[model samples]
Target: MNFDFIRRDINAQKAKSQYRQLVCNSAASKGKEIVINGKNYVNFSSNDYLGLNNHLEINKALQEGADKFGVCASSSSLVTGYHYAHQALEDDICQWLNKPKCLLFSSGFSANLALFQALGKSEQSHFYLDKLSHASMIDGAYHSKAIVKRFQHNNIEHLTELLNRSGKYSTGFSNKLVASEGVFSMDGCQAKVVELAQLAKSEQAWLYLDDAHSIGVIGKEGQGSNYFADIDITMATMGKAIGTSGAFLTCSEELYEYLVNFSRHYIYSTAISPAIAWATKKSIELIKKEHWRREKICELSVLFTKLLAENVELVTTESSIHAIIIGDEKKALNVSEQLKKQGIWLTAIRPPTVANNSSRLRVTICASHNDKDIRCLAECINKAIT
Candidate 1:
């Protein structure tokens, strides 16, 4: 049989305790709670950072958009699929991020791929990425026509050295791009975006930020990296903190025009749902006005940290994500099982998602969670881990 290595690889994964599977959710408010197998769980693995997943205003906007423009784009963007709702959402994102232009995509993964492939015209283009960047980024950069390099995670010195030594290996590379995430997903740590911006400017390189995990969870109005530094290019997803679907990439007028014309991913793919685009705009509006939501998440995050036992090691972050390192895959899974028994839903993040011997419980503290929820979660975690 052809492609028979699939079975062997799967069995090998099972033997290593690295097999993956998905659990069905019976129902969910997707706020502080979710139901599975007819039992409710205090959801800590959710990405609904601002807890706006089921907001009434956004729902209303979605319905209105459906009634007006319908949900589907009905064709590729380059064809007749580009709708008014998509244009409005793009405009809103451009204003929110202070960018000259914006473009929408079905998903952040496709956006990343499109950007890298479009910019990587030839060997004259070089792409430098952070070591801990998302999988989509790695795939995009590697598959592109550009020369690619990875610096140590969050290490400004390493990145600087790589840039300084670029000419030592090759010359005449006109386009140099530096890419990083605003907030890393697994570790919940933030990139040093200010330093990156400065360095990229000095080196005449373009800075690209994937703010998927940071949007609607940072900045005064949740403008993410734009609030801290002026980035050359940026992509943020609506499904996470934005509490909607699809993604948007913001860039200069020149780059936007280039992508629309030259990017295969953007030119061929069907545009995102118009109704979801309308709902995403509403979510962005909510994100700007709802200071209480951000404040609550901060307050609750601090409380959760304080409540944890000293023996428990937590990766501290300014974002909604928190990682509790368990150091072993099976141990991490056991701890997750124990938490589930306590009616707390925590997921075990194992390799190849993370490094070997660094399995963890990736917890997301939402604005919807109260002090009582934090206290109980902390208490249960303390008992289970110990």
Candidate 2:
């Protein structure tokens, strides 16, 4: 009786076509193809942008790490969980991003939460986020003690106006922070990193970029936003492009110390898997050297675009994600089902993940996919949508 709202919310979600359920893969998925319900499907819904999900070397490193350092951290980093693997991974990330320090977390969501909660420690802190930032970032900002404002997505002018306006309400000196995703997860659009960095510099605000979808997919060396601009903070997940588990935050030494000392999430939580960290380090190394992988994604993306029907509303994106807007929840799901029948596994992104009536099939064109795969997906999507 006391938890009646839970049932009500579930029913409301079902009625609105916003209820979510997970689909389990029957076999090991290595990026390009997946087996589900004893059938194979071209995996367009995967986030392994660079197509290194099951690299032999990375897998070997994971095994090596498990043999050397065990799988789990066993304790909090401050207590005893900070293994050599984590330290080496952190060091590698710091060098790769050219940051003063790096800290590892269990996942990107928790890392975002920890960063916001640590930096927004007082009311004097003001956080401005892009309207289309990842849900984790929105949650982090809203849950923090700081005053939060949201600017129009990728609108530098709107962000500037908000930054200027924040001064009017602050009682005294304020710690201002601007947060955005380097590459928006759903829409596959990139933030104007250079402009944002400049704006943050002029306003004396820290620019925080969530590169969950960018790292290991963007930049010549896969340094992500750091290659384009000197960001104050960057958070990226190893699970997406690096094809491993856990996440890391790169920041200045001072901010790093502040987070390590004050962040409750960091202080109390157990460190990420040592094996995964080691594997992630190897993945980053591969990402940096494998220019062909990034090029493959670009080539396949262009081919996919060329093949899709003119009537299909696929958004142009430089990133791996290709969002085909269907504008209706049921319609999007129907299209997804059609694609599934044609041996393509594209998921329908519904409301709450996206805006109302903007449900889409988020297609991820990875390096693992070939021209044949692209043709199949495009033709299927084109026929289904048209």
Clash pairs for candidate 1? none
Task: Flag clash pairs in model 2.
Answer: none
Q: Name the runs in model 2 displaced over 4 angstroms.
A: none
- In order, candidate lDDTs are 0.92, 0.92
Cα lDDT tens digits for candidate 2, 158-243: 99999888887666999999999999999899999999999999999999999999998899999888999999999999889999
Candidate 2 matches the true fold with a TM-score of: 0.98
TM-score of each: 0.98, 0.98
Superposed on all Cα atoms, model 2 deviates from the true structure by an RMSD in Å of: 0.9
**How many clashes in each structure?**
0, 0
